[model samples]
Target: MVTITVTRKSQSFVAPSELTPSEMLELSAIDRVPGLRHTVRSLHVFRHKDAADRVASRPAEVIRAALSRALVDYRPFAGRFVGSVVAGETCVECTNDGAWFVEAVADCSLDDMNGLDYPLMVSEEELLPAPEEGVDPTSIPVMMQVTEFACGGFVVGLIAVHTLADGLGAAQFINAISELARGMDKPTVTPVWARGLIPNPPKLPLGPPPSFQSFGFGHFAMDVTSDRIAHVKAEYFQATGQYCSAFDVAIAKVWQARTRAVRYNPEVEVHVCFFANTRHLLTQVLPKDGGFYGNCFYPVTVTATAGDLAVAGLLDVIRMIRDGKARLPLEFAKWTSGDVKVDPYELTFEHNVLFVSDWTRLGFLEADYGWGAPSHIIPFTYADYMAVAVLGAPPVPKKGTRIMTQCVEEKHLMDFKDEMKALF
Candidate 1:
């Protein structure tokens, strides 16, 4: 086993290089959802490269300077989340508080950790930054750590509160930092903070905020190769006479296989919830140029009985997922207009709910900070819920998607693996 040691060199706050607005910024209803109150964490791994100059070899200094510039436009990220007088609402107090930054050094190279691939060998605590024991995580909207390895390679770990942005929006913020690090004056696509454009929900009764709870799930990484996905897509098209996306087939297979492996009671209700991007759906309100950096995706859930999922054909499962995604526009409208009473953030694990997040199109790999694009991008840790992360595999000749899942218990883990293997 390879043991990697990381030492912290410095810790400080990175405020915006230029002065930003000092006012309260009201977050959209989607941003203030109770479920998204937690922090989102990720790690970006970059390989060692020969540099022309000494200053260019240091990634920490370059990123620190670039992050300061990036915060000028994304000022909301530097602010803290404050509760609103209105029930079930939170807003960002843009006090220019600044983001937390850490510089660290790792004693090993990427190769020592298997190219920083799936089944991450290093501890998340070593790579990601965290708040002190008494500090509230939400008070720091963003925290970043850059850990350079002995071989000159580095890893960038980030933690951002979900209320500030979703996967795409967060990627936009990081990309801006990358642009500035690469000597660009500004980001390619300017960010827009049109939070009010998303209609607010009518005043609703406030409830106790949700807390994180772990179910002791055995986490596993399942790689679905491109060839396997292609074969499944072909089979689906032949059976349904309709085309389906890679995500549709992949998620359907996992949901079906998991339901069967868990052996839930026939009458037990099972649900698979995934977020659908509303950028195109809300083009009238959001910019089409991809500048709206906020939480614009909403959850769409497909529910069925365990017995039905176990017996249903793959094509049928895919159709159910398709139908669920198709309802995003209407469901989002109802949610915004106060017609739907269901709180999207009030999630239940109960071993029956699967929350799948697709990060394949989030543009995390494009964050090239002078060295080059990162070779791999992965979440720092899985959520306590039965979470499934669909991420793009590391850059390789044979491309594939890595599905990191934490749903099955230890006893049923082998059965779940077998079921997934038999599908391909």
Candidate 2:
């Protein structure tokens, strides 16, 4: 019922002039480091009829206006990763490849878009979380349409570079768009650009930012799905087991069992790195909802192998991850300009990624444009070994967990349901 009108446009999504000193420092860090111009992180979904109708009536002028305002108001651009130092986004668009646009492949039964990859796999064995008590199903981000098909189904998608913002960051952007549609003012909190988190690059500095090689092996760029993935989670608690969420408990037990099964060197700096937004550590604290909307999450990590962690208590694992998150503020040393050059590291991994993102709290489906909010949003559209999307689902008896996985070890993935039974 609400309407929004766009009245302004800016060349870059972010007005570099508005950046505070620290924010500039943060942005500067990105400039110093090289970025991966390709393989942007994006999410896509297919929409049904009524929703497509609502989108169809919406003019590109209004939508583009809304997007521009969203860019300025929320500035998803601010959180994006400029290309790598060696193979970064071209300083100019004409010189740049298709690096600026979010690239997604949607291939349904139809053949409209030149580069759309359809849903390759769908499974009935998996479960879905029930939509919250009263949320509309169509408003979900995964349900938005990139381009409506002649058959009436619509394709919608989201592209985010891991270095920029992760699932939480993308979710915040979607929610802001919804708020704009309702004519809401700028979010109460502005985004704290992480660039400032980096210390001033050395007087001369180590040239540009570190490239992918400086960190580790090559990066990941695949398309995964349920049909392609093999994963399973079960709800279980032993009479003597510790109290914890299913993820914490299961991972703990698995680690314990795995370590006992193998030998690991204690000297190794192995860790479990998960997200906990470090917005406050940035140069400036924007409004609570700065840039995007959602809870400020931080990456929680721990160092343990199959055996040690698997045998740990539930409360213990929770406490450990909590402590790891608290230490996030310590990482602000980059802002302080430590001796080590700033190198952004992505927590995602191939054949070994464990994402425990809670989408319900992300406010993704709550943000409605003109028509309504998205009913469902799912990650793990790429090919992979293990990936989990923790969002609300409707069919499971209790809250359900949707796991997506792809790997050479089909046995490890196909044994998911059995693993759930074992975890229980």
Candidate 3:
């Protein structure tokens, strides 16, 4: 194994290039969700083969300049989240503070680190930026680090508060930076900060936040070849005469394999939770040009007994997932009207729940800073047990799907692998 060491050369705040508005931006209920108050991190790796002259010579300077320009429009990211006057809620105070930026250098080349692929060779803390010890993360809306490798390759690490944007929204912000880095005068899509456009329920007192307990979870990644996915879809269609997407079939397979590998009691109830984008559902409120970049995705869950999921046919699981997805529009409506409330932090941590997110279509891999698109994009770390992310695999001859997970215990890791292999 190659030992990787990243040292920070400089750290500073990159403010907007132009003076921007200073106002408090009220967050939508979805944005103020207690569960999303934390920060999410990811890493985008670029190889030296496609590096352009300017970016290859001074990656940090180019990105920092681009970031300053990008913040002029996406100014909320340059602000901090503060407690709202309405108790139990938070809002973004657009003070035009700036985003925390770090310039770093790595001791090893991208090749030595396996092109910064799955099972990352270095610690996430070393690559990603974070608030200083004892400091609140909410104080900083965005944090980024650019680590240059000896091979002229580089890695861009980002830490953004979930309250600011969901996966797609964050991608839009990154794409804006890339556009500027490539010398575009302006972003293709204009940013919209109409947070009040999304109606919020009346403020009501709520119970204390739920306390969570840690589990002995281990992170794992598995490659499910494109051929295997196609084969399963074909088999399902032939048997049931129905169509299923790659996400539908892939997640169903993981849900089933994980349930079996955990060896849960036959009667125990288990849940598969995933967020569904609701931008289309809010067409009346959101812009038509697809510029409303905020937290627009809502969580949807499918529940069944452990035994049922373990023994259920792949087709049955796929149908269950599809059915759950079909409920997003209605569920989102209820959520908007305050008819229902979901406190994700209140979810049980007994390993009976699986949180799945699909990143293949989020466009993170499409972010280019003059050097070409990233070779690989991966979450810095899974938030908790049974947190599964379905991501696009690095460019390769086959180029399949990569399932990154922190689902099973160390003892059951081998069993989980065996179960996943049995399916393929």
Which is the winner by lDDT between candidate 1 and candidate 3? 1
lDDT of 2 by residue, 192-273 (tens): 5443433343442334432222212111112222221122212222332433343444344333323332334443333554
Candidate 3 lDDT over 354-419, as tens digits, reads: 888888898788898988888878775475543454555754434788887788888888888888
Clash tally, candidates in order: 0, 80, 0
The digit string of per-residue lDDT tens for model 1 on 24-98 reads: 988887887766777888888898765565344489999999999999999988888889523546889888878
The TM-score measured for candidate 2 stands at 0.54
Q: What C-alpha lDDT does candidate 3 achieve relative to the native structure?
A: 0.82
- Model 1 lDDT-worst window of ten: 389-398
Sort all candidates by lDDT, best to worst.
1, 3, 2
Runs with alpha carbons beyond 4 Å of true place in candidate 1: 51-55, 84-86, 204-213, 387-389, 395-398
Task: Give the top-scoring candidate (lDDT).
Answer: 1
lDDT of 2 at 329: 77
User: Distance (Å) between predicted and true CA of 54, model 2?
Assistant: 4.1
